[model samples]
Target: MAKADITLRGRNYSIACAPGQESRIVALAGQLDARLQHIASAVGDIGEDRLLLISALALLDELDAARRTARPSPEMERKMAEALGAASDRIEALAARIESGG
Candidate 1:
């Protein structure tokens, strides 16, 4: 296993990942942190847990919108659906971790 140290909302976390996935995990964390910062700026510091929940919902809304508007061939649609499913799973896992105070 590999571990990536990520900072979100000014706090650091060590995330475990498969070998060779550390950079990908760090990059995803950076994107998430950026979104969290933007949400915080708009809503003010309403606590990390709330901010995270809001961010997750906002992301899901965007994804849903995109899915509705996207038009692709059957093969491409299959690939996109698979990718979205993976992303959803990851989001659920992250939410569970946050809920558990991990």
Candidate 2:
């Protein structure tokens, strides 16, 4: 457990990572910087923090949309099908009992 100091864009940040993870941290920081710069360029002039927050929100929105589009998990689908089958079985049993009594 080692601490590394990194300066990204115009701010200094201290990150904690295991040994030899500084490069990974640096690369991720670079990607974040590039994304922020791109966002700033697309929109009008704004504060760095504001732009950063907007970028984060944009990413979250995209992920939310993707989640909405994805199909339900197989286990969930199976459970739903089972529930429907059970309801169908109950209805059939009720109909049979009514016919027999009549």
lDDT values, one for every candidate: 0.93, 0.85
Candidate 1 has its poorest 10 consecutive residues by lDDT at 68-77
Regions of candidate 1 where Cα sits further than 4 Å from its true position = 73-102
Alpha-carbon deviation at 27 in model 1, angstroms = 0.9
User: Relative to the unseen true structure, what is the C-alpha lDDT of residue 74 in candidate 2, on a scale of 0 to 100?
Assistant: 88
- Model 2 scores a C-alpha lDDT of 0.85
Q: Report the C-alpha lDDT of model 1 over 1-102, residue by residue, as the tens digit.
A: 789999987799999999999999999999999999999999997988899899999999999999977868899989989999999999999999999999
Candidate topping lDDT: 1
Q: After superposition, how far is residue 88 of candidate 1 from its true place, in Å?
A: 35
Per-residue lDDT tens digits for candidate 2, residues 1-102, read: 876676666788989999999889888888777878788889978987799899899889988999987978889899999999999999999999999995
Residue pairs in clash, model 2: none
Query: Candidate 1, residue 11: CA error in Å?
Result: 0.8
State the displacement of the C-alpha of residue 6, model 1, in Å, after optimal TM-score superposition.
0.5
